[model samples]
Target: MCDMGQWKQSQHFFEHLLNDSNNNNEDLAKVECSLGEVLQWTGEWSEARKYYNRAYDRMMNIKPTRIKDLAYILFNIGEILYLEGKYEEARDYYERALAMQKETYSS
Candidate 1:
């Protein structure tokens, strides 16, 4: 399911998880992040951003321990922005994501 090469199933699973009302914010965030990755790989930039943003929002609602997931979603956001030719914005997001990753790894 982690393979972007088989994104359709990944997309289906994530979407199903997202629609599940019983899912917690952390769970939804994780699945949304995965969905963002699949959408990104499939060249669905806008859809990818939507999922990334949703994941980020959900991550923000959780504890500080969840920031690593936020960073990952930000990285995907950067990737999408880069593909859209928003290099400066993309770089900013990449830098932010990298900084968060460093902080998480260092802790």
Candidate 2:
């Protein structure tokens, strides 16, 4: 759905999935991330960041946390900031993501 550029449809599908699931943190996080991407592509940077933040918060509560997932979200956020002309902030996020990625893969 998202790959085809149907953002609204993708958002609706993700929202439905989120609503239908119960205590499914993984699904929740995925939906939030997908929705955030849609919002970002639509130029709703603030709203997108809100969803990204929610996804990150949810990820924090999951067991055996995946650093790559967190870093991916951070990278997306960095891209959004870069697009919005917040170069310094974007650099911060990019560096954080790069550090996490290196930490995860270095071992």
lDDT (C-alpha, whole model) for all candidates: 0.87, 0.90
The C-alpha stretches of model 2 lying farther than 4 A from their native spots are none
TM-score of each: 0.89, 0.93
Q: Worst ten-residue run, lDDT, model 1?
A: 1-10
Candidate 1, 1-107: lDDT as tens digits: 65537778888878888889999888888888888888888899899899889889888989756767788888889989998999999999999999999988897
Residue 19 C-alpha lDDT in model 2 = 85
Number of the top lDDT candidate: 2
